[model samples]
Target: MKSRKTRVLAVLLVLSLLGAACSKSSDTKEKKKTEDTDYEKHSMETKESTEETTTETTEPSQRDTSVRPVSTPTPTPEPIPMLTAADIQSMNNNNALIVYNEVGNVSTIVGRFFHRPVADEDDAINAIKGVQELLGLQTGYFPFAVYGERFQGYTVYTYQQMKEDVTVTNATLKIVLDQEGYPCMLQSSLASNLDYTPSSPTITEKDAEEIVLNNMGSGYRVLSEYTMTTVYTDYAKAQHCYQVYTNSLIDNASFDMPYIVHFISLDGEYINAYPTAFLPTDPFADYGQDSYFKDMVPTDYSFTINVNGNQVDITIPISKNNVDGKYYLCDPDRKIIVADYYSFEFKGQLKFDTQDDPNSFDAAHMVNYYYYTQAYDFYKEFNIESTDGFGMPILILDGYCDESGRAIKNCCNMGIQYGWSVFAATDGYSFGHSLDLVGHEYTHGVTFYSKQGVQYYNEYGAINEAYSDIMGNIMEMYMGETSDTEWAIGERSGDECRSMSYPYKHYQPMYVGDLYYISTSPLSYLSGLDDKGGVHDNSSLLSHMCYYLYMNGMSLEDLTWFFLASIEMQTPNADYDDFYAIFVASARMTGHEEIIPLLSDYWESTGLKGPREQTAENTTLEGYERINIPFYSAKVGAYCVVEVYSVALGGRYLYTTMQWDGIATFLAPADGTWFLIGITEFSDASLSTKVSEKWLNHDLTAWTDDPNDLGYIVFESGKITTFPTYQ
Candidate 1:
């Protein structure tokens, strides 16, 4: 049993050892598994942490999802307030504000208000500011007042304001006052918040008449009564004021029996009224009140009378005065009426009676009389208060009985031969004695003044005649004349005057062909019989040239190019050839390429060439020989030194010598090539046979067209022997 117990104990011990061994092995395995799992978990955690840190550090703040997200913020806007009528009205009434009335009673009222004089700038500014404030302008801006002193009673105020925020931006206000310091009108312009509403002025017909009567106090005579149909507008009223003020007269006799009234407005509309009967004169003794009537008295009748060239015929009738009977004619009874008869031609007989009735004479006669009287009055008024204010001496021979053709021929001959200016009549009896005759003669005077002694022959003459014809046409147009009338002399007289585009229409052999021969001669004599200066034929050429130039879209300025050039450059005795040269050079110089071709064509058409050719080249002067260098070098100290020996014929040599550091430097040999040189003065060669010497020395006869051909020396053996050199 003991042995069995021992064995059991041993077995127990073995069992215990086994149990302990099993426990140790199990714990070790579990610990190892836990450690391995922990290690793996820790490694993963470390890697994740490092990756997160790296991402946080490398990513931009905006892109970082970990940070807070951003969004666009909305901006707050200011509110626009509504403006009330009361507010606007209050603003309009504000003394510090300015208001502008574009239309209606407001304008009239404002005009009347401004008519009164303000004491000072403060008063003016305050008044204008009141208008501005009433106009609803915000603060910080004011209106200024403008007063007219010349009109005696004109005033206006102008102002400006910012539209968006009631800010006063700009303001201008004016007040016009009469000589009596009474307000005539108030004018204002301003920037405002309120839109404008136009209202018509409440002025009745009786009220207007009353105003007129009140303005023309006493002694105001109504020579004639007239009615004007006007649209009821502010502009019309203003114009009416001007008309009434300027036209009213105290007496008709003060205006020479026929009291004429003219109505003109700032807008250029015009009207005239005349009294048909003699005016009543005041018989009261001369008193202090007479000055009032005198102030309102009208001067002589004035009118801008336009004669109809088509319907009117102008005739200067010559009377039988004993003053060189062939040259002058006068009327003692003034029976030879100077009348303007209108129609295509002069069809009425000459009337020797003097009748004021316009219907008794032909339309031409009446129109002519009206124009002459008007022109006379204009001249008189122009010369009223001066010595020789009528611009030189002008003789108006009225009631002269002479043939229109004869008068024209005499005047034209006198003018061309002795510079006499005459206005002749155009009766259909004589050829070439038409409006053109007067126009051409008149143009000579105009040209003399405008151009001041312009060359007369060839192109200039042609242009002159053409311009005269144009002026004639213009004058006809001014006289309300048209080509439809038989008075179109250029079209009627077989083209003697001028055509619209062609001047050759008048180039008849009898009139022009022979005239050219006599005129072109150097010693050409004039016969006082023809209108042209013995060159009647060539005038057509010049006129035609001008016509063509005008037709080619050339402006007056462009046309003046040739005129200016001719006047500036042409010699007194310049002929057609010289004219051609001048034109070519002028056209080129003035940068008028279009004129160049035209000038060329003109020259060619006239059987002439244009300008001469020009050649340009560089020349050099070389030493004659080795020893000749010192001789030339010695000349460097002389007064005249040869610089360049030009090869062209009539070549000019440039000579110059200057001192450098008190040393005389020689520039003759230094040109064209680099060379050593000492300081020396310079002098030009006195040799007249320079070309001959050069030719003999260089043996340049091979290049000569003639033995005397001494083309400019370009270079002398590749060394500058012509021009002086300086170091």
Candidate 2:
């Protein structure tokens, strides 16, 4: 995640309308007008001179006027339009639905496709191809890679998509099957419009590398091993670009962001660059065959550590290499290893040396040992072994630093390079001390290995960040909360970085069009904008949605498993809509369909259905159901204060919220007469007051100091009639 520094955010005051791309050409009529005027002046002068010199006047020409017949031109015939997501949805059975990306490719398809069980890999591929043809997906979607796995009693087949021979970044087609291997649902992020004229790059691979290096400047070196030319879609247009992987030589200096990915067009034009670090931000080390785990002695190390100035004792399971007679900071049973800076640099055995020092690097390792184990145990309950589900060792680099020996304050999952590994650097205090942060980093690995995972940018990156934050908080809760409360991350570090329950407190968006919402509309995957297109900033919308689920009776465990299943159903280029579909599929798959209604309500409330608009409705609402009422104002920054007054409570205001977006959410407190009062800056505009169910029980002091004293006129004569009695 980006550095969680507190600051005020500029509101998205106005909505922008999107139109088709077009070009404008102006006719040069001004020059012609000047020439014509000059000629007219000369002609008039010559006429007068001729009249004075010759004294002869030519007879006025007789005017002739005749109506002419006009011919109509036939209009050109338009090209046959290919099937779109809407068209495909209309043609398919109601049970199966497909969602297309901005580029018109089927990003996700969730539901049963085949009438019967798929036979094998060949059957799955053929079934997908036939579906593509039936849906009129004109692009070529050949399977470049295919694999099968089992989870939650379901057998799943995953196919990576490619165009011609070039790889499509983060594109995949997943075929899920029930226990008997029958096809259940399909998901994809394949490219479309493959008929574009192809041309070879003017710049060679070496030239592309040099261009990227020059653009990246000094103190940065490209990791040539990870560089590859792939097809990336931007603004619905696909182009071949080189994905250059580079990192900063200095860590945490804020000059060159680490794990920077530069997308250079194949023709060598620089497109965009940004850090893919999992905190604000890999293959395999098979140590199982080594003597370390084979001949290791298991032990439990106990230590007293300071957490928010309070001493707490904890125990973590670890192992000692009997062959080397050194204790390693690892739990062999859980397949986790905590490597120190020295061990990572020298590639030596990560030996645990000390246990009593509270401020030493060993203490940091112990902290990671405890939390990583907790996060592992949390996932293990869902039958997931590790990040890869293959018992791969979860490597945690404790006391990690740059080559210059400067301790970085940040901790990022280095899984992009080293599979299933997290490298953290500490300055004054250790990030290992924060459970949510550690779990946040750990979940990054989980997202990396998720079935369709996702690329780390734009809306996809925001979802990635939200997964870590949500699961991190869940993991913190699973391990038993200490200094920090639920739904808030980073409170243990003295600064409440983000609040899942109230995202607005941190200037993060709670809905799609909320204050900090970032637009990925054109679908530029490599946009190097702020916070990676607000990946960390807009992530709260999803996290708060999960929080809403938790508040509306979804158990944490149920939410956890459901989210894990949803991630399995996701695509690499998924946005909010794609996620909504995936989430619905997961709800049914996890046997929690009861939550779908509330989830849908949350979706609409969060603006996933589109921007909030005014609608006609009864003044009164039933029970705890929330309603959005839009109020009109002639100016921006207009205030609409909504209050709930209970006669049972001495006719006093029970709750109030100052809404600026015009939409107000209301909930009835009890059974009796409740007055809904609306105080608005615009008295002429028809408006209604509301106290959103979300803000009903929470403290309203943050919204305003006694909204009744704001001295604003009541909406439509102030007093909305009695609300229907709700149990």
Candidate 3:
């Protein structure tokens, strides 16, 4: 019955691909933003590279005359450019998939194209460059770095540019491949004419600082809390300007708090560089002198001294940074404060006051040790310095829930990349104090912030949660003392570890294909069932596999397998299929091909076979009602774009259209929630792409007769979804 079901779905997948190919291809605006500037913020997309456009499904027999499995995963893939005359005919109808209104200074190609899966990514890239050549555009003009790809049928590649060690905004490229792995449809943007002569800064750093201080409103006017200044060029409103980076004490409780970036125009006007987002980490922080010293990791100052009439040695931790001569990194966003349930009236953190409660000292001491040490371990091991790889501080809100900023006895005992910081709860010193737990929580931040983290939330989100758990298990195995050695996550908080070796022992699924296996709508899982749709519950499957590999034979190279996988595949909305392929690909790249057999054994044991060939239009799917979102903004024009995506993993691209008077209606592919992405200019990487790819391609200030030379109109939707804004 399963094979029959597979066959039926496979046939439908092929038909949908064919019908999509046959239709005149309308394209998505190419908006590639790189990860360089993105900190531990809202991670990347469900934008799987080269997503095959889903067409209205046809009856099984009435579709393609040829009947073949659309997405088949054999031990050895047949690398064929499966193109027919029909495919070419479809390609002609959808030649230019990208829609440019000749307004924004970006270029992209998005639509259907013929392709064959190449054995290596380098080959696939070359195939894409071939397409660019055919389009009569200079290959160098479209600056992008391919961040993701699907190796199976209909490979899609997502690319963003990171030039000069900074993220480019307003430029992106997405190339779609046919069943044979050839470029068919492409959606991308490249800056056509840019001014990159490093225009002399008309303002000084002091002047910029004064501008920032003057413009900062009440509740933010305390001048002493601001420290650490950095100067860089910022391009957000489609213009180049200088920017200042600093940490401001958001709350008076402590000094040296969260990070913020203030922009200054050459004319000394203060610019809110990132109006709708958190400021990125230091632009110059990617490289630094390496020191293999433990001191490199922040540690609590310990001392034996007579204070309050007693000689005692005390070492404690709470959010503190040089408060009365002790160090603690507190929340910079000032969102986390003392919780209500905790015993003490937690006004400020546990300062270096001997009168402070002993329990307070212990909680602070232990949690900080775990948080800081594990953070150091990530840098020493995988070269990720901070959560977002830009030295963003690990914001540990002890005895407080990150979301609520109040102390609930056992509130939110996990690690999260909240507002570009690792917001962790002290949880009255339970899992919050455990080394493995801290590692587990912090690892979640790393995974969410990693380049591969673009696919951070749904199935990949489950993978995100699982990666943290696995790391916790791995850390305990490699670094834990004999008494503490155990392969479980939230061990201290739950009083037992979720068994990695025998997950079912903990009432968790040990295999992927279990009756309880979850693959869609992560929110439903979180909202409906336990363990948030098996994020922690189902992680046991992957964790068990990791433990088996460790018990058998695993090395740093083996452990770093996931790290490499994440950096390369940042598909924001990834799923089981995307994960398996990426895992296998990472294994192959890291010379751990010997582990492939184990992967097949373990993954197949759970019933997960890469990505299933199914359409978003599957009526058989539960809650499968289709809805249309009418997007009408009075302020949108040729320069504007409207994109709607499934809010789950694989970030299913639902629809992309242009609005004249800000009204672009989208016929959603499937049910559940959809994210509406409206772009005047898009993505984090496109900013740099504009300067480097277009403006600096030849140091030319201007180009003529560009299609992207258009303008915008105000857009509004009845749904009121979150989107990037141009203020």
Highest lDDT model number: 2
lDDT per model vs. reference = 0.27, 0.53, 0.37
Cα lDDT tens digits, model 2, 291-385, are: 33566666786878787777878788766676765666667777676656545543434544433322343565677678778877877666556
Segments of candidate 2 deviating more than 4 angstroms? 1-96, 134-140, 163-167, 178-182, 193-201, 233-239, 248-257, 277-292, 342-361, 416-420, 451-453, 483-485, 519-528, 611-727
Candidate scoring better on TM-score of 2 and 3:
2
Q: How far out, in Å, is residue 563 in model 2?
A: 0.3
Q: In TM-score terms, which candidate is top?
A: 2
Per-structure clash totals for the candidates: 109, 11, 86
Weakest 10 consecutive residues, lDDT, candidate 2? 33-42
Candidate 1 per-residue lDDT, tens place, 441-528, comes to 4444443322212223323344454445554443343344345322233342233443535433444221122212112211111111
lDDT for model 3, on a 0 to 1 scale?
0.37
What TM-score, computed on C-alpha atoms, does each candidate reach? 0.28, 0.66, 0.43
Candidate 3 TM-score to native: 0.43
Error of 1 at 472 (Å): 3.6
Off by over 4 Å in 1: 1-422, 426-437, 450-467, 470-489, 492-500, 508-519, 526-534, 555-574, 578-593, 608-727
Q: Is candidate 1 or candidate 3 better by TM-score?
A: 3
